[model samples]
Target: MGTALGTRSASAVIGVEQSLPSDVVVDISGALTNLVADVFALYLKTKNFHWHMSGPHFRDYHLLLDEQADQVFAMVDAVAERCRKIGGQTIRSVGEVARRQRLKDSDVQELSPGAMLSELRADNVRLREFMLHAHALCERHEDVASASALENWIDEAEKRIWFLFECSRN
Candidate 1:
């Protein structure tokens, strides 16, 4: 058992066969778990913004967030599975996700459409940064598969940020 990300419960170390060292597996698993948590957090926030979206651009903004939310959600399973494939267990509960998540949650009753887009854009940028950090870790550990996976995710995050930035602009 080892600490999974920053969460309290010790993650059950699995016996998945892989060439990487145990420390590398633990590090990557913790990093990927954090990424998964952030992805889930961002997914829900995107949906929240989509559901509550209003104003002159309601149709367009709503559709955009809905699409982005789907894209964001598409990331979860791949990342979680990557953690497991690399010889560490993935997240098992919503509570685990909440404890490991690094992204901020929104609870505002009202927000301008611009504000929502801006917030999501910022979050995507941060997500990209987080992926890059994990990528760097993979690089340092010579974990080619994990690094390659993070590259695709980083690209997706860039696309999301681009869309949100363009949409939020006046």
Candidate 2:
């Protein structure tokens, strides 16, 4: 098969190149890769909170973090796959994720339950912002499938933010 871009895979007898413009693919893939890194970082942070939760509300908080972490993790594969579908590469290692992630790392050895919730809520909000930008890029490129996927991700991130906000409220 011939790629829409007329580029042939070096190792494949028959392979198709991406149909999207190179610049659009680069932009979308870069955005998605950054989103993947942020999602992975957030997943680890949520899991850390889930494991270290301590307080009268420990059980509830732990369960919430676990659920939220699972949701964040679920986005990783989809984002990477989307990059691949566009004939772009994604983060291949933890170091790459670290380099690309925009979310700041939590350096405190201990964080209060409220602090954990607040931090996660903020990060989710940031992730939603990135998703919105990526969605716009997809729209500009007429990539409806990727745009639809981003819409779903944006909904998920918004729900997480709402839940975290509610949980943090006194």
Candidate 3:
């Protein structure tokens, strides 16, 4: 007798024979999951800063954070989708995100506008570094699709970093 999906045995699972080796997919997805977590964390932080921003530059800073938050949030879905596309498990919950994320959470107290900008800038730099490392791993595994996605993400992060740095200057 055959299994439900025409498999002769019960051992075979769907998507088990992905184009990329399972190990490579697992490794790439792990990296992408971590990136997703960080992006989510940053998204929340940017929103926090946006909501709490004040002072003479309130409008400018608030709008900047809002736009940045949107950009960060946009990446989250792509990262998770890419992980699933490669036949690997994605982050399942907020706890999973916290466990995988490398970004630090901000304090409940509102930070100064400059302080917020600086912290976000630093986090973006870190995210960019992680993306570069992931890109290299993708290349090593010949995962061109993942590598291409990372390239676009890296460019976006770099622009964010540049804008944040400019905003931070006197």
Candidate 4:
């Protein structure tokens, strides 16, 4: 990501280098929007879990939720940085998050511990799906590096979501 360091060659895809194609630029815009949706989902779910969770595992769950919130906040930067790198506009509002998010929303106040896990797992699944779709989009545009990154993220999301969902079942 260093501007002065190892630069990948610009392809037909936009923003990879100077004179990026218009369609690629637009595609980057859409990707950024969806990524912000991801950020919103991550933040909301973390807060929900941190507040609502209860059980014999309460302390563990609480700490994990806090950790997740921090990690997710950090990722918000990565996603936003990707948008900036691609010369696309980043999402600026909860309204924009709602508009662009593929993830489902839930009412935080209404949620119980079990419900929090359920909704968070659902969002992670949604994110996994989005990453897969993004990977396919990159494939069509012949953007192998971007496709690879998306595929990696999709796998990680699926694995984490599965763990959270299974914990809820027990």
Estimate the lDDT of model 2.
0.86
- Can you give the TM-score per candidate against the true fold? 0.89, 0.88, 0.89, 0.78
Candidate achieving higher TM-score, 1 or 4: 1
Worst 10-residue lDDT window for candidate 3 reads 5-14
Query: What are the per-residue Cα lDDT tens digits for candidate 2 across 40-159?
Result: 999988898888889999999999999999999999999899888877889999999999999988878888999999999999999999999999988887667789999999999999
Q: Candidate 4's residue-wise lDDT over 83-167, tens digit each?
A: 6666667888888887877665566466566777777777777777777777777667555556665676677677668767876
Candidate 1 lDDT, 41-133, residue by residue in tens: 999999999999999999999999999999999999999989988788788999998999999999999999999999999999999999999
Better of 1 and 2 by lDDT: 1
Q: Give all candidates' CA lDDT scores.
A: 0.88, 0.86, 0.86, 0.68
Best by lDDT: 1
True-structure Cα RMSD, model 2: 4.3
lDDT of 1: 0.88
For model 1, what is the alpha-carbon lDDT of residue 93? 98
Candidate 3 lDDT, 76-115, residue by residue in tens: 9998888888788888999999999999989769678899
* RMSD (Cα, Å) of model 3: 5.7
For model 1, the stretches where C-alpha displacement exceeds 4 angstroms are 1-17
Q: Which runs of model 2 end up more than 4 angstroms from their true locations?
A: 1-18
